[model samples]
Target: MKKIYCLIYILFTLPLLSQEKEGITHSGQLTGNPPFPIENYSELDNPKSTSETLWNKKNRTFVSWANTDVRYNKEIPAPIALSQETLHLSAWKGEQLNAQLIISAHRKSLELNFEISDLSSSQSKIESKNITGGFVRYVMTDELNKDGKGACGPRNHKEFDSTLVADPIDHLNDRLSIAKNTTRPVWVTINVPRDITKGKYTGEIKIRDGDRILKKLGLEIEVLDRVLPKSENWKFHLDLWQNPYAAARYYRTDLWSDEHFAAMKQDLQHYVNAGGKSITASIMNRPWNGQTYDPFQSMVTWRKTIDNKWSFDFTVFDKWVEFMMDLGVKKQINCYSMVPWRLAFEYFDEASNSMKTIETKPGEKAYSEMWGAMLKAFATHLKKKGWFGKTYISMDERPMDVMLETIKLIKSADKNFKISFAGSFHKELLERIDDYCLALGENYPQEILGKRQNRGKISTFYTSCAHPRPNSFTFSPPAETAWYGWYAAATGLDGYLRWAYASWPLEPLLDSRFSTWAAGDTYLVYPGGRTSIRFQKLLEGIQAYEKIKLLRREFIESGEKEDLKKLDTLLNGFASSEIIEKDVAQSIKKANIQLNSF
Candidate 1:
């Protein structure tokens, strides 16, 4: 009976299997992207030689953005076109597939023919004679074509090449397969081995489909050099969240001019000199008055008048950027604005012909235009000087759609774009954050936000291990924030971020008087020669805690699975133990205070 049943099942399913395969027809072709060259020079335009310039000067990443209405303003050459193509690597490990390429050509029917070559273990490299392990798998979509369904939104599709690949090799051992195209922007991808060496790796991907060769685009992949093993003890990422009330506000001319600038620089230099690595400066012109600068406002108003062509004046901001650079401060500029609050008008009294106003209704158009101009100017300056990855652009507390658009514009202008944002653990911001970091995974979020994204974008909490305000008068500082930080890190937060490490110094800069961060009357030492005994102890504890966190990152990043597991077990074992329970609990409390203080 069993044999008979088996035969009957196979007999019936055999017809279904044949039908399924018959229906699984190739609907489209997987074509390589066309070449679109944006002349990327190395370092800068050398003053020494006009013709002696090397074709490939330095290692660089491609730039990308979302604007189709490109009007050639010969007055200024368009910024070096970002990435010649959008490189996608959505494929996983040990997959039979090699890569995925999407072109902006929209044509009906016809299957895509892909040419897969195994650069790893193949002979006669140029010829497609030896097809190895990998094969192409793709489904064509008008989505990323010359229509709105692509990276930017609807009606925004312009011709461009976008390539996605799954290479198993490391940075040094990358292989490329190109697609050919003439009219549309072509996409190309280079797959590198996981164990790529730490050095400059250069290669080229040529796009072609059948007889026609599309274009040739250069590719540069740089594997970051490993950091000092000892320095890995401390996590050095911190956020600057000081608003007007806390920040010492003086006239821009007074504070930013020579005298004040020098003083400020000296102070920061002292801080870095003492022991500071990174500081994110929240950019706000004035202090926040709850009514006017209230970040709690739901709707952000913007002037509808200014379209894509609008521009804003950012003279003062230029100086700000310069000052930050001069101070040797690694800063993240926040393009955050309150729409309705920025608008000067509130209610109008028709009887007296008087209109109530707020602080300034800095329209969104003006903000957007100003930011774009600033980025273009800054990016161009950096590119010319070649500080591509040194600066970052950040947006805090803005709508997702608007922020995404802003990111597109900034990225379109410069491929090496970085941004960050402040997020709330509240339910609203937590849901669907992956969409925001849709392109870059959570590891390297250009738009730094408070929330976390898994496999999508990188994020860190604002203050999960420290309090904005510490009880200076009392010697005891909260230990709860530390626990919270640990919890967040455990849940996959990239890092822990705190705002305003030291706002007000208590005894002539000995200790912070107002905040709970104070540890007795002692002041932590600053580069500017300010220190308090209590704050010093507090800083010591923080430094130690952060060191533990950093060790966790290094362990995980080391790619030693067993070591990671061991460390995890050790950390978890001590998590609830009395040995460090108070420290962890106090850290959590401090973190909560800081979050709620806002």
Candidate 2:
């Protein structure tokens, strides 16, 4: 009888012991002050006590080291007893690399600060400015989503648990307190210079409380002999759809204000750093009918004059594209979308003196005339800005029957116009579309990809609500993020796309859940330009893609058939349906081991 009571007590007390700052959501800024105006989202802290683990053991307060792939929740005891571990890494020149370390305070609260030393290669040194540190912040994942479309288990992943899940990598500087028996993660980011000498680099990440040192982890990296092209030059296309309105709303600034642009620039710079290749500009209002928290208002205002002529205000569209290009995402402007989920066309009515929405579907005369004029005008404006060559008229998940008519309408508007679509496989529209994206698990026929490759067209895949694994959902395993790059390479894809870049919730820093999607599905990075662990791990995968591309080319040019076969085999291993947890975890592990050897 006594044993049973003791067991029950331990079960209930373990989770409570870890969240010292459990209910506190005030600090949202990277400054570590207020997270947002709403001090608390009742759901930020679970209303009901939830179990982090089935069983655990009590231990003394201690610090430890953990890899970036590991997601340590605040509600459970640190899984490992590792007090220190070396951060072994490799990067191509001009690439930004990141790693994570854990500081566990078991059954004891702690106020901690941190610092990172400069990385030096015997030849040259990387300054502290290039290497930055941040502490990972925790947000509540109150419920595991069973997405309406479909999803696998809401199983044991902490990001899916209804507890305090550490995710956002906060801006370093402010001292933070760790809850008793909880873990705090310190993130170290390194920006390798393009011109730096190629060799070994070593550094130390010092964990401290004020002037006292708690631990120092050894950091080592081999700047590979091969130089990776700068982000702007990388061929692996990355398109993370952007939502500018959310930044303004979360930061409490006026839309398009100087403050808003300043706030947005920070996050956008991070995107560019990750090799973002496309500018996601909306051409039609509510492109997906309020799928996001903020309205993706039409960048170009469409109006029918009293004289029955069509005119467009490209002021917003031009400013956005120019701003993004100036920031280095200059490859393609993917303007979404011509075939919106709902065929509700919004335009300024000169006769009514108001914005009006016309409900019309594709193939209808009204729809044809309305879009035809807009596309023609849009083409003219794009040509004026010298953007016509790189601009793609993009759409997301509309039916094939509709696509045929829309494609016909688009080509009729302007023969040179390029069209992009990301959704289910569409064989009929293949010849007509320039940039094509299919959902994960959907393969593009070899012959189709071959032809497109010769034509300088792009063939890629995307993961959205339907894909159960290898997805970027907040609670997804960190290994899944890296899997995207490996999978793309294995399948001979040009690149990948994640539509949710910053479709943030009310207080993104505090909560990452939504009514319909899994936690963290709505956004990747937090406000104030802070990147999440998920985002950093994603960088790990993309860097892998670039490395593979570089190595494959070098091997072929140098006639290294043996190495080429080895590389090809490794990538081919990732070609499997990587939706299973154990298989993906093992594949990522195996690929990383073999990649570093090369």
Candidate 3:
């Protein structure tokens, strides 16, 4: 592809080149976005010949919300153009909200500094520490034109591009080195303290260039009388499968070494902060048959004695479980695969004195004998460690026959063992599975959900290469993550599930294209525990869920039927799949207006 210039736009703004001294502007964002450039500058603005400058500068706009990718060497995206003015925000105590302040080096490379002031209310004040920000860095990303049917296949899919086309907000930095005609974005975060007084607090964010202020936007936060419980207290059953192998590979550390755990901790902190409630554990090698760049090795090692007796080693498994528990993802431990993509199982052959692999199906004698011995031992170990109740034997998108055989095998071994499933809805297994997650667009029977709730079972939903809009694809709109909460509310689901969390590619922070799945599809947060715009917005969505949950309960307690009914009606619109097909940010914003009014 070639860089396309806005010839007519340049012609219209060339005469007004001298007005730049009045305000600061830059360009970024992407195509497929509305073209609403409100500010333009020319080379006449070049006071710094020290850096590269263009004869014609790209256009930039002041936007009310940023939901598109910010691209360099690509056409700028049209923003919901707004004049520089106060950005009003509302949040409950302990809630975190995010926004962007973009400053591209339109005329020349520039240096930028940031300062956020302390906001004051009549009863109290919010410290400057509550408001924090960092420069947003661009990372390369591939795009998927189609869903690819959610296949666990190799790379080089014709429907997806191997080349990087989009650069979404994937990194946060304290400093940036911008080049000519390129852009840099500042990610601003406002963390309302749980104990802050219920009143309006006022402040401003000042962006400086050299010694002079480049731009200043007023920040007014309305701290609600209500409080959003801490992430630890959240009820959302967020399950993002972790890949320890990826962390070990990314950091060049030995598997399960101290260095590896340290490196993994950095990334898992991002997960814990999002109110993560589950830990992914693989009981067999290559659980998904190498779908990801990294191979997921089983924590429990299988061994056989010369006498033909089976034994299991829980050293790695125990360490992993304790590690995640220590980090606060202690609610559930999801063990992968009574049935993997492939039926090949591996074990140490004591008689042969070598490692061996066996191919077997669930019902056959070989498969049952091997898995039965392991589960018997696994249950005993879990009971000894006090993890028996929370541990679940989890399976992915397998066929109905396979699932039935596998579930039978599990129960025959020990009916007390729990099971977690993520796939198409099967009414036959609804009473059997403990934690059931349906895929996007796959409806779960609303009436059945009540029975599951009564029985203390979980019913959530997920998205993969199959769902396009309202997904966390790197090129997807940032608001889509938040739209997820609205979807959950509309459907009355517990939470969301994603197959990959930190299943990093060869180079995640730079190029997010993987050979198998969609680009950036294998991960949410970046390496080194950095949070992306998508991940941040995902937290935003979870927070939105928590807030909405609390508000609904409050309304019910206070008998505010009108407000509660209006809120329910607003959420009902999301029940239709058509909401994601449209611009969700507009819908969410309108809904928020009514929510804040009460």
Candidate 4:
């Protein structure tokens, strides 16, 4: 009896021990002192938390790496400034022994201060290796603004934030902010605990004046038993190709339209037939001045009304969308970024030697506001047409203030209209609304690459899809490519978005004319009459893999190891070394057989 009891005890305890060892969680909050009005304090934290605090005294002046007082210069930009005057607190977990925040910005005059909350109050338990002493700021003054007043900190046009959990290789850039001031290029770094967990953490940094407290940022940590899933599901976003340059070059050409709207309808129908859902069509005005009609050398303009409303000429855009729906291209449409460009001046002439900005009348809302109204108008129009719950509205890369106002406008006009944007913007926006978004794939490759369930539909990136040669493809292993789709499916990605699918012919048009270039290899269209053939094969393969995924999911749910092994074996069989590793001299023989089967 004693021996049997010991075996049972050992069997039951091992798994629990392993789970505990692997478990890890992290979280933080931003908070500061009272006095200044915290217009939207809640924007500083995650909105999904049940016990969320609304904008309050603790969030008074919202300042940070975004708004600074420094003069704008090409080399250094201003510090992130806030309108408040109080200190704050924040918290985090070190997790493992290898974690660090690399802060590199322009300006050294800025400073940092950190404090760890010892929830346990045990001095002996404090970790020494986990703390980084000070923050380092970079200052460059060579490039100043046209006014020569501030540093323009070289525009790191490549802007995006990558989380620690994402794929490292895919992250092409770091979380470095551009300084618009030459005198203040302060970048700070903080060493974090290697394995700290379940504690209160706080920190404070002051701008030059020091009287106003930057946004009080604080985070409380409670290492939970299980971490929540990163996202709800894959979201699909389909938008009409609003770029006239692209539309004229591809869809609107004499060859394409002259033959058939058949191809266009077919593409849409096929996508829907393959379980694809959702589309985003824009109502952006013509890229050129309506009068001049020139493709290049144009600017954006805005118009607004007394009731705080806006309008646009959507006849052309409406025609395209109506054609799709009329042809039974079944998909929900998300009216994305209603205002896409700043229109050129009405009086401007294409024949003219120069152009200038059109000044708006006093008290008139800016171009962005007019754009927001357009979004509301479109949503209202769709609702009246019985597409209320079937549609959504979104804004991208706007200020937090504008986002909140827009959300209010959208909701006021139609309560059911879904609102969202790209997730690469301000954190405050994430805290303020239930807005959903598509993560920019190209913006943060590291976050998605190789990470399971890391990507989904509606993401954007520049990929070398199916072209050949050194410049035609990314040259990534099949497994690496496969992982993107596989992980996207696992993560519930709505749909994958690329610049083009079948642009046709493998000729050199962009980079290496006549010769091949990898950058231009994303097109799905092959040269011969067999364009769709190659595309069909790739699609079919993807569907087959999707089936395998379903089978694997079932196996996991059922805990059937043998079933999983069988699926793995079948997968391996398809790409076995025996089939792929043939010598090139004789491999043509096998290659012919394999290609024929596909």
Candidate 5:
């Protein structure tokens, strides 16, 4: 009996000894064998945690401590607080996932360096491409203008107010100093390669201040056998208007120069990597005036010969096309402005050795003739360059009469021309356009939209200053940006379009506010480097949409109408509400779960 008692004591003590060896204390503290003194650290899924170890070991642990609630009130436009929890990220094979963690510095300014452990075993490990850092971005916000116009109406050229009167707000940066008692968001992205092996990979992200380990956050990625297709397979026709001229202005360089080209290439590559499909091409000067960037010159130039014959110079235009093609913008080259802002066109006149303008005030004979000839020349060039089929003559926020007139002129030039417009949804205009990007709140007959979509017409919706909800801007929540994709799937729309991609303010990275438009209106991306949180959220939304599309296809192939109905129900419900990030993630998770079961 004494011997048996000794055995029981040994068994219990042995386990305790093992726990101690692993740096786990009887008080449940993880004092993992580090040189420095580490204490007062707790893990939470959110900032408002009452206890440590809020989840299972397999789950991600967000580290945070109890603190006073940080609110965004009127007194403080940009208040910073510590993140309530650490960040957790999960991704499938061939998918990229990102998460933001809030870090607060309470006493004084602090700088923290972070490194991740190798998530590998003897057989397999996550590739360097699969794990990367320094992709951090700051989160900024502005007060919503309550008195602003609600939705963009017909020919509504007026600006939508964001009411951002204060200086621009941004979370403290990781590379830069974090102010005392200030909070900031740090973003980390993980890309699971398409050919990665299936299994659970575990690692730790250690936050350090010099030689001291401030915190060791855990990371886990579950790589499945499933492969996410390329961004091109995402059926949505996403068009974020590009501003190469913005690149030049921001960088203080001449257009198409080595410096300007490099900057523009960076911005364009960022857009394409984030699932932007439609490329905006300027065929005339100042396609949309009074906008973010300066009036861009027409890529195509025309000259009258010494003998009074008309000639075209395709040098600059050809270079632009080649550059776009090199960047893999073969999906859709959307030519800006068959009828641009204020119905004006400008061109360089080599014969006169000067630049000239043609204004299309009603019944302006010179304007009509000049525009007609220009359209004819553009159509012929597009056809000869093999860009006609993938090209669309685009206009923005113009009146019905103007759009119709522009379409007529283009069609007369080339009968097979495809026209794309972002205007108020007009029933009569639905059948006339190959691509109609309507505002969200426009009174449109669903039957017409459905019918147009059925006939292979590309139907999309756009949001700007007027239609602020469900927007990809700093003021809006990241989840709302992601919901655009799910919303498109539910509504049976082809895709989404935002007016600006790189239209920067005077100091875009510092402040996204614009004088004429809403804050964060001029651009989705910053000037010199890195993408915005809104942009990343947009990518997530696109990924979610693509996942849903693939699952729906599988369900159809497998004849699982019930599963398909369930997914549709979830998506429709999400679409109808002011969606949160959790709901979007849950919906995607549930849909994937259902898909995997098949």
Candidate 6:
């Protein structure tokens, strides 16, 4: 009997042991804390002060890191020397403060553990709740072969080419690994709540390997009493085109799937949270000439009868409108092309009970008739949905004559329709166009800029493959992005626009190279739910613009003419520089100090 009882006991407990070992003993319950704790520390020191084992100089495992006000040429690997020792950052209450610690490893792999202690002193303590740690994988530049070929692709532009192979571990919330002497930039964001006590808070960042601590870096954040308002009062209007269809394709989901919708919501929320105000809505088949992988899913579909009469379906349109409104994107709903490039489309024929396709060149009677009906229906729908006032009938980069014809067709449908275009510098079309998105290098006539500024129209400039300087990319310096806002303020432009925000390349997370455009031209943020260092830097620039605007407002309101003049001088001088990242932060800091004193 004892032997039989022993066998049964063993049988019953073995399954439980296996389950525990597999990390599923209890369904839906997590195992424990991660391998290392993420917390703030009070000290910064290198664990291997004298010994060089932490980074092997000969094997190229040596590391170098620093905290900079702006990032420039960050894709290049750093030298094997310790660069900087501490992180000093500043922000106003209700602002997200950003700092980056760029780590370069040469020729060896490393596993690092990180933690931060609560920032505190005898007077006050800011808990870990107000702090969060995350990182983005940085791709390094590779040596191009004699043929100008590399892992990413052929080196089109010398400055924008990258040789780093994409790795999953480079993104945030994953194990970090440096391939044989490469550099990776890890971003740290501290969101200071509005109610937090305004003062200087200090802490340390602990990096280790198992129990052996690698480095402890000091952190100091000075939170000012002045609060940056969360309201959408920004003078700059930015529209980074949101592509949901590409997102679904990249993630391998149906366009209407819950997963796709959830992913889109998260991305849009991030965009709006970073001071983005405008939303891109596709009225027809696709935008940008189907330059993307999948068709730009139209919110509204059309049906045609035997008599050539057209009707519409609004199921998808309604859902998208409700979804965007919930995400606080009511500022501007930009509807793409009454006349898209190539003027091609497919619609259902109700009388024949089959689908029909139509491809017509510009000025074709068929094109005009079809687009006229579509625009009329769209205008009526927008009015019914209460979005007409905020909607723009958008056409992108078309010939001036073609744009005029398109506008004429739109007016035939609804004379009161507001039109928006991103095309060449056409002096004749300025009065007719409601929103003009011109190239950054294009000369904007003062009268045009003045009229748009006075009428609150969106007179913004965009950049793609045409211009290289002041672009938002991994290879470009962080200051390039910040200059967009500063330049806008100095030039008296109302806003800025980029063609694509989430236009994913074949292997976007690992490589951003496209066949036609520059490597980073296709997109700003990465797929698989990751944010890029470039995106963060862009936010920094936008916030910097906001800060300057606030200072100017206060100075003007207080009747401090001298201070206001000083602020103007500072902005104008910074705008004049080809490289503005290095000095913009310091200038803004000095200006803020002077404003605070008053």
Task: Say which candidate scores most in TM-score.
Answer: 2
Measured by C-alpha RMSD in angstroms, how accurate is candidate 2?
Answer: 8.1
TM, every model: 0.38, 0.88, 0.86, 0.39, 0.79, 0.81
Poorly placed runs, candidate 1 (over 4 Å): 1-235, 241-253, 265-284, 287-328, 331-388, 399-416, 425-457, 464-492, 502-528, 532-566, 573-598
Error of 1 at 357 (Å): 10
Q: Cα miss at 389, model 6 (Å)?
A: 1.0
Clashes of each: 86, 5, 2, 81, 3, 18
* Candidate 5 error regions (>4 Å): 1-89, 121-123, 135-141, 146-174, 304-310, 350-352, 361-364, 443-447, 577-598
* Pairs clashing within candidate 5: 47-84, 62-86, 63-86
Compare the candidates by lDDT and give the number of the best one.
2
> Could you tell me how far off, in angstroms, the CA of residue 95 lies in candidate 3 after the best superposition?
0.5
Q: Which digits, one per residue and each the tens of the lDDT, describe model 3 over residues 14-100?
A: 232233233211111122211211111111121123323232433442222233223222223223253445777888889887876
On the 0 to 100 scale, the lDDT of residue 530 in model 4 is 17
Off by over 4 Å in 2: 1-60, 142-161
RMSD of 5: 17.2
lDDT of 1 at 368: 57
Give the per-residue Cα lDDT of candidate 4 at 146. 33
RMSD from true fold, candidate 3: 10.6
**RMSD vs true structure, all candidates:** 29.4, 8.1, 10.6, 28.5, 17.2, 13.0
| lDDT (0 to 1) per candidate | 0.32, 0.75, 0.72, 0.31, 0.60, 0.63
lDDT of 6 at 490: 72
Evaluate model 6: give its lDDT.
Answer: 0.63
**Position 18, candidate 5: lDDT:** 43
For candidate 5, lDDT tens digit of each residue in 504-540?
Answer: 6444543344444545666777654556667776787
The 10 consecutive residues of candidate 6 with the worst lDDT sum are: 1-10
- Give candidate 2's TM-score: 0.88
